[model samples]
Target: MVHNYVMRLNNLQRKIREEELDAYLVTAQDSIYYLTGATYDTAERPFFVVIYPDSPPDLVVPELERARMKKAQGIRVVQSYFDYPAAPGGNWYDKINALVGGISKLGVEPSIPAEISSKLWARDIVTYSLVSELRLIKTDDEIESIRQVARYADKGMALLVKNMYNGVSAVELLALSRQLQKEIVKAGDYDPLDNEFITVGRPAPQSAQPCSVPDYGDRLRRGPLSLVCTLRLAGYAAECARTVFLGPPSGSDAELFHHMETAREIAFSMIKPGTPCAEIDQATRDYFESQGLSEYILHRTGHGFGVGSHEAPWLSAGSKDVLEKNMVISIEPALYLRDTGGFRHSDTVLVTEDGYEPLTTYPATLAALTLKDRRPLKSLKGGFVRRAAGA
Candidate 1:
């Protein structure tokens, strides 16, 4: 892990030189962790990593994180403040001034804090630059990390399905998903950086977007429910989404689902080296429109993901990003109908040398999605139980 950090810094240095930048200031949580092995949430607190072409890197963090930052290997100097608002004479500006005191040009990411930027005497070179592009391609070890998390997400989905029933409320379904994720983490002895998202409800009309969290009282019917799970393992991430049906699908629902599947197939088939990213999205949309399901389309095909769930090299119409080997992205083609529900299966895919490979292993077939029980579930309202699944 430490070696990976060193290589990434070296790469960033090269980019700095090419761009004629004197120094690069990084503040994004994911970018900081990607460059150095240090990880911490940036909630309310400011964090930064400064890299210079000629000088060793310096890290400015909260005093609380000072001990943790010590464990990180690539950084040469560690500076900390007791907390936010800064202590007397402990201003980060002074440390930064000392580091790049005489520099004539400085590079910074989009999210760099105003305080730091305002104090810089050098001309600011603002851009994502090497940081964003570096994350687009995953190393062999990074890909393996994502594979493990994808498996965990698959398990979480199975748990949700096993507990699903006709009358199960959206809230209950979400609870089950969380429980399963916790169990998987303990059983596997994995670090707990995993994130799980659950969406359950009847699909809304093409004009109406469904809320990620269902209505408090909305209960599942013998229709479609969308479940999406994203699990992060050691900072590498993968996602799995499936549209499940409570019972055997009706003829109409099956046909709509088939169109959804077709769109997904179109996107998957086009994944290869040098294929323009927008073309994949455009081709999928074209297929859906040709089938006359354009109204039901909600959003773009998918987006790039890694340490951050949504990153660079987005797969969407109007984007010029071209697919490259080791670039990880999600291919999700979905349809929404007022009467039926949402039909989507999002899979994390890797752009390989020859083609693509799906990191998510969950089956997306109709038969595989059919639930066995249509049993009524107990209703719970504001801390009170009003009914049960078997009753």
Candidate 2:
């Protein structure tokens, strides 16, 4: 594992050289994890990583993370600073002189707050925007952990859809979805969720507009089409979303939903190493335009996932980042109408040299209700999420 981890760091070093950068400063908490394997929130105190291409990287952190970095392997160099709220010069700025060694050009993640960047180093430290784009791809071990999380998300979403009988309160469904996510996380040997995403059937007859009503207490009913639902299982950062029908959907509903699914397929097929993200978005947009539904695309084609539910390497026209091997992304393309609800489907795809591998393996079955059919109609258990079939 450490061998692969070092190689990943080397890949970033190569990227740094190609970008004409001398070093990169990492402030995003997850970027710290990506580089150092020392998971930290970096909230209580400043945690920073200074990576110099072809040299041992330096980590600046409060004394709290000293032992943590020591154990991550290849972390031979680290600088620790202390915080004394009651004392002067208590901030980590003193270590700046020691940490910012020989870096003429610096690459920093834009996710770093402006305030943090302002104090990190000298005003003249030529800073370039450097997000951990390489982190978007999935390693075998990383994919395994996320697969567990996505499986849990799929089950949690399934539970939400299964209980979508008329008169079920949105709050009740949301509560149930949270409960299911808790169980799935627990099953994966992790604690209950600290962060998650759960949304129910939207409020639109034929259109997919933002819910004006607080979706918390609204009762879900059979609508003009299907429901846009999602459940994020733990901050392990797995996401599952789908447009499930309330009852049997009509022909028009099925046709549109399948079209949205097709858009998703086209986008997925377009992702691979070396493909520009703009072309992928254009293809999806062109397909939607061909279907005469160009105005309904509310957002980008997709976004990167892992460590956070949303991050860099966005799959949209605005992005110029090229896809690379091992990158995991969500190619979710949806059409939302103001008259009818939306049809949204997404899967977390791992970009491979050959093509792509979808880590999110939930079946896109129109007959999802059938899976719920076999289960007993007992009172809804607090946190019983049906696991994904193969998981």
* lDDT, residue 212, model 2: 39
Model 2, position 117: C-alpha lDDT score? 71
| Native-referenced Cα lDDT, model 1 | 0.74
Candidate lDDT scores, in order, read 0.74, 0.65
List the pairs of residues colliding in candidate 1.
203-341, 376-389, 377-389, 378-387, 378-388, 378-389
lDDT of 1 by residue, 114-214 (tens): 77678765645566557987888888878877777777778777766776666666556555555655665677645453344443433333213434655
How many collisions between residues are there in candidate 1? 6
**Candidate 2 lDDT tens digits, 176-213:** 65566556556664433224556455434533653333
Off by over 4 Å in 1: 1-3, 87-89, 113-119, 187-211, 215-217, 338-340, 374-391
Model 2: CA > 4 A from native = 1-4, 13-22, 63-73, 77-80, 84-87, 101-103, 128-131, 177-214, 224-236, 250-255, 272-274, 365-391
Question: How does candidate 1 fare on TM-score?
Answer: 0.88
